[model samples]
Target: MALTAYEQGLLAVQRREFAAAREQLESAGDDPRAVLLLGQLAGEGLGEPVDAAKKLSLYERAAELGSAEAAYNLGAAHANEQRYKVSLDWYRRGAELGQSGALRMIGVMYATGQGVEADDVEAERFLLAAAASGDHLASFDLGTLFAYQRQDPVMAAQWFLRAAKEGSAPAWRELELLVPRLRELPAGDTRARTMLGVILAFHLDERDAGAELLEVSVAEGDPEAQRSLAFLLHDNAGLPDDKARAMVLFRTAAEAGDGYGAYNLGVAASDPHEAVRWLRQAAEAGVPESYPQLADRLSELDVDEEALRWYVRGAEDGHKECMFAAACWYRDGFGGPVDLVQALRWYLSLLEVGSGDGIHEAHKIVSKMTDDQIHEAGRLAGQILAADVLVVSRRT
Candidate 1:
C-alpha cells in the first residue's frame, strides 16, 4: 500500500528531507495541516529561502481552512511585528477555537495593557482559563503577576510551584527566592512545603543537610562554602570527632584568604600574637562581624585609636551595632577627641536606621553644638541615608 501525500510529507519532515516534504505538502490538496506545516518550513528556511510574505499567506490560507494552529501562528507573527491589534484579532480566532496558547497571550495582553487597558481582573480570568488546560507559561505568568503586581507572596509561590513541576526553570528559581520571604507556606501543598524544606535544609540551619549540599563546593575548593560547612561542623552537628575536621577546613579556607575562616581560626588560637595577626587579616578583609570582635579586643587592651577605626569600618559597612559603637566612641572622646559634630553625624545615621536609642544621645550632642555644626550634621546624615535608600529601592 502507498502512503497519501500528507502522510508522505510528514514522513519526509521526520526524516529531515525538507525538500521532499515541501513538495509533497504543497501537493497534499485541501489539507490545512499540510499548508500550516509548509508555512512553518518556509518560515524556518527548511531547504528553501525564508519568506515572510509566503509564510503569512500560507498561514492565512490554513486559518481560512479552519486550522486553529494556523490562527495562533498568525497571531504570534503579528505580535513579533508589534501589530498588537491585528494580533489580537488572530489570537481571538485561536481562543474561540479553544487554543490554550492564544488564551495565555490574550491574558498577557490584558496584563501588560498592550492592545487593551491593563485589566488585572480580565488577565486573571484568561490566565486561569489557560492554566486549567495545563499551559505551563500561563502558570508562570500568573506567578509573576501575583508576586510583583499584586504583592501576594503566598499565591505567587503556589503558581510558581505548578509551573516548576511542569518544567519551567525560571519558575523554580523565582519560587526559591520567594520562599524565604514567605511567613507561611501554602497549606496542604506537599510540593510547596517540600520546596521550603529543601531551601531551609540545604541553605540554612540544618547542619547535616548543609554539609551534604556543600560537599561538591568544598571538594572543588570553594573557600566560602568550605568555611561555612566547617563552621557548622564545629558546632558538632551530632558528631564530636568532627571538630578536628572542622579545624582542618578552617585552616584550608584561611589559607585561601576567606575572611570568616581567618576570624574563626583567630577565635580558637591559643597564642595572643597569632590570634591578633589572624584577627587583623579578617578585619582588613572587610568581614563585618570581625570589626566588632577585633575592636572589642583592642578596647579591652586600651588600644582606643585602632578600636575606633575598626568600629568606624563596620559602621560604614552598614552594621547597626557597630554604628552605635562608633557614635558612642566619638561622643565620649574615647578614640581621638570629643568632636560633637562627628558624634552627632554618626548618631543621626544610627537613628535613621532605627537601630540605636540615639535620639536621647543626639539631644545631648545638639545641646553642646553650635547652630552651624547642627546644620552640618543634618546634611551629612541626609547624604548617608540617601545612599542607603537608593540601595534598598533597587533591591525592592
Candidate 2:
C-alpha cells in the first residue's frame, strides 16, 4: 500500500529528505502549509536541485491557495532568479495579504533593485507600510534608509530606537555610532540623553548602574536600546563572548535586512566562505561599502571574476578605489583580455569625478601610447566624461 501522505511527509522530514516530502506533499492535494513547505525546500535546495522555475510554480500555487508564506517565498525566489518584475508582483500580492515578510522584502527589493528598478520613493513607501504593520525588519530598514540615504538624522534616530527595542543588532550598532553625534545638538534633548544613558549602561563596559534605563527604554519600544542591549549581550565585549547570543542577534538583524549587522557578522565569521556569503547579503541590501570590501577580499583570494564583478559594481556606485582597481585590471588584463581603451575610459571617468591620484596615474599610462593612440583615447575619454558629468549633475 502507498504510504499515507502524512507519514511520507513526516518520514521525509525526519530523514532530512525534502524532495520526497515535497513530492508527497504535492500529491496530498491542497494543503497550503505543505505546499509552502515544498516550495521552500525545493527553492532552497534542502533536497533536490535548486530549481527556480519549479519553486516559483509551487510557491505561486500555494500562494493562490492563500498561503502567505508561499507568497513571500515566491517573491524571494523570483528576486533570487533575477526575475524582478515577477518578484515585485508576488511581493505586492503578499504585502496586500498582510504578510510582514513579503512587505519587508518588497521594501528591500525596491531599495536595491533586486527584481524591479531601484526607486527610493517606492522603497520608503513599502517600508513605511511594513513598519505600520508592526514588522521590526521594516522599521530597521526604514531607519537606516532615512539615516544614510535621506540624511535625515532625526528620523533615522527615531526609527533606529524603534528597531532596537525589537532586538535588532544593527539598530543598536547604529545607535552606538550615532549617539555621540546626537548629544552635540543641544541641551534639553531628553531623547538623546536618555537614549545615551541606556546605551552606556548596556554597552559601555561600565557597571550596570543605568541598566534600568535600558530596561525602561526597551519596554517603551525604543529599538536602539533593545539593539544595544542585544549587541552587548551577544558580543560579550564587556561581558563574555556568547556565540549563541551573537547568533540570535545576527539572525534577527539579518532577517530584518540590516546590511551593517549582516556585514559585521560576516566579518566576524571564521572563513572567507561565510564572509562572502554575508557580504553578498549586505551588498544586495544596498550597502555600497560592501562592494569594495567584498571585491578586495575576493581579489586577495584570487577569485578574479567575482572580484572584478564587485569592483565594477563598486565603481558604478561611485567608489573611487574600485574605479582605480578596475582601471588597473583593464590595463593589466588581470581577469580578461587587455583593453587599453577600456582602461583609459575608466581612468578618465575617475578624473572627471575629481580624483587627483587617478588623473596622475592615468596620465602616466596614456603617456606610453603612440601619438595617434593618445589622441583617440583622449577623444573617447572626453565624450564619456561629458556624459558622466551630465548624469551626475542630473541626479544631484
Candidate 3:
C-alpha cells in the first residue's frame, strides 16, 4: 500500500526533508493540509528561499480550501503590508473558523479603526473571545481600552491582572502605572498607597514620608510594598541596612512575580550561579532591562552564546548599547558565524532610527562590502523600516 501525498508530505516534514515535503504537498493540490503545508514551507523558506508573493498566493489558496491557519496567515500578511481592508476580511473569515489569532486581529482592527469605523463594542466582543482562548495580547489591549477609553479603572485593573498572570510584561507595567492614578480613590486602596509610597521614596526624594507610608502599606500585606520597602532599607543612607530582612523581602517580592524583585535579587546574589538563575527568571518574565544586565554578566562569565542571545533580545527591544554589542558580535563572529550582511543590517537599523553614533561604523562597513551586498543590506533595511521594527518596546 502506498502512502497518500498528504501522509508522505507530513512524514517528510517530520524527517526535516523540506524539499521532499514541498514536492509531495504541492502534488496534493487542493487538499487543505497539503495546501497549508506548502504555504508554510514557502512562507518560512524551509525548502527554498522565502518568496513573500508566492507564500501569500499559497496561503490564499489554502484559505479557500478552508484552512483556518491559512486564513489567519492571509490576514497577517495583508496586515503587515498595510492592506487593512483585505486583512480585516481575511481575519473575519478566520474568526468565523474559530481561529483565536484571527479573533485577536479583528479586535485590534476594530479598536484601532484600521479598516473599519472604531467600534469599542465589537472590539470588546472579539477581544473577550480571544482572551478566553488564551490570547495574552488581546487581554492586554482590553485592559488598555477599558482604562483609557471606557474610563473603567477597576475593570481595567482586573483585565490587566489577567494579562499579567499570562506573563504579559506590558500588562504588568500598566498595572503598576495605574496605581498612582487611583490615589484619588478612598484610602482603602492599599495597592495605590503602596505604589505611591514607593514612588515618593525612591523617585520623588520624599524619604521620611515615603518610608512612613510604605510601612503602613507593607503592614497591609502588599507584596509590592514589601519589595519597595526592601529597596529603601537597602539603599537609603538614613535607613538601617538590614541585609537579611532585605533578602527576605526581595525573595518574597520575586516569588510574587515582580520582575524588579527578581532583578534586584539577581544583582545582589553573592553566588554567581544564584545570580544567573535569578537573572534568567527576570529576563524570561520580559523585563527588557534585565536582558542587557544578564548579557553583560554572561559575557563576563565567558558564556558568549548565551550572552549573545540576551544581547539579541535587548537589541530587538531597541536598547542602543545592545544594538551596538550585537552588531560587533555579528561582525566579529563572536558566538556565531560572522555575517557582514547581518552586521551591516544592525548598523543601518540604528542609523535609520536616528542613532547617528553608528553612522561612521555603518559607512566603514559599507566601504568593505561589495556593491551587491550593500544593495541587499539597503533592501533589508527598507523592510525593517516599513515594519516599524526600530521602536523601543513597552519600556517606552
Candidate 4:
C-alpha cells in the first residue's frame, strides 16, 4: 500500500528534511497530526523560519480538529506575549482534553491572578492534578505556592523536596533558604534539622552549636551548608577568622558545580588570570553576572578576542549590554576583521530583543553597506532570530 501523505511527512520530518515535510504535510488535507506538525514547524522556529501568522492559522485548524497539543501551543504563544485572557481560553480548551501542561498553566494563572482571581485552592487543585499527570512544572509551582503564597514552610518543604527529586535547582535553592524555618517541623527531616541548627548557631550567635551542626552537614557533603559556612568563616563577624578554611570550602562548592560558589571563588582570586578562570567556570555554570564581569576584565587586559568571545557568550544568553558590546566589537574590528554582515546580524538581534539603544548606530552601518550587503545582513539576521527562537522554545 502507498504511504499516506501524513506518513510521508513524518518520514521527512524524521530525516530533518523540513521543506519536504512541510510540502507533504500540507498535501495531507485536514489530517489533524499533519496540521499540528506543520503548525509546530512554523511556530517553533525549528525546521522552518518563524511565521507567526501561519503558525496561528495552522494551530487553529488543528485545534478545531481536536488536537490538544495545538491548543496548548496556542495558549503558550499567547501567554508568552502576555495576552493572558486569550492564553487562558486556549489553555482551558487544552485542559478540558486532559493536557498536563495546560492544567499546570491554568494553575499558574490562578496562583498569579494573571487572567483570573488569585485562588490558592483552585491553584492547588489544578497543580495537584497536573502533578499527578507527571508535569514537573506543577511540582515546582506547588513548591512556590506553598512557600510564598500560603507561607506553609512544611508544605513548601514537602513539595520542594519532590521538585528537587525531579532535578529542580530552584527547589534546592529554596530548600536551602527555608532551612532556618524547617526546624519548626518535627525531627524526622534530618537535613532540615541540620540546616536549622547551622542557621541558629550562625545567626543567633550560637557559634559552637552552629559549628557542630555545620560540621555534620559539611561532612555529609551538603553544598549549601558548605557555602554558608565558608561565608561565616570568611566574614568572622562573630567567630574567629578562618580564611584558609573558607577558601577550601569555596573550592569544594565550586568543584561540586555550584555557580555562586564558583562566582565567590572568582571574586576572591588575587591573580587576574586566575580570577578569569574561576569567573569562566561560574559563567558556564549559569551565573549570569559572571559573564559581563569576565568580559569586562578581558577587555581591560586588551584581550579583545577573548573579550569578544565572552561578550558573544553573554549575548547569546540574552544579556543586552553584552549584545551591544559584541556588535560594537564586530563593527569596529576590535577583536577581528570587520564583518559588517555579522555586526548587522548582532544589531538586528538586539533590536529584535526589544532592548538595543544602538538602533541609530545600526542604521548608520546599514547606510555604509551596499544593497547586496544589506540584503545579506537581513538574511543573516533572520537566521539568528530563528535560531534564538528555537533555543528559547526548547528551554521553556
Write one digit per residue (lDDT tens) for candidate 3, span 1-396: 234587567767767888888888889978987888887787788869988788888888888889888899889888989999999999999988879989999998998999899999999999999987767788898988888888766568668766776678777678767666766667887765765675567545777877888788777877778888888788745544576677788888899888878989999887777888889889998877889889888877888999999998888777888878888898899878887777776677676566866656765565566644654554555432211222212113
Q: What's the lDDT for all of these models? A: 0.76, 0.70, 0.77, 0.78
TM-score of each model, paired residue for residue: 0.47, 0.45, 0.55, 0.51
Top model by TM-score, which number? 3
User: Candidate 4: where is the Cα deviation over 4 Å?
Assistant: 1-58, 62-139, 142-181, 184-190, 193-216, 231-246, 297-306, 348-356, 370-396
Total backbone collisions for each predicted model: 0, 9, 0, 0
lDDT of 2 by residue, 242-324 (tens): 55665555656665677766776666777887788888898887777789878777877788888888887887666888888
List model 4 lDDT by residue over 188-254, tens digit each.
5546655565545644567677676676778778776787678778887544448778888988988
lDDT of 4: 0.78
Candidate 1's residue-wise lDDT over 94-186, tens digit each? 888878999999999999988788998899999999998757799999998888878777678768867876688898678667866563654
Shift of residue 155 alpha carbon in model 4, Å:
11
Q: Give each prediction's root-mean-square deviation over alpha carbons.
A: 24.6, 20.8, 12.3, 12.5
Clashing pairs in 1: none
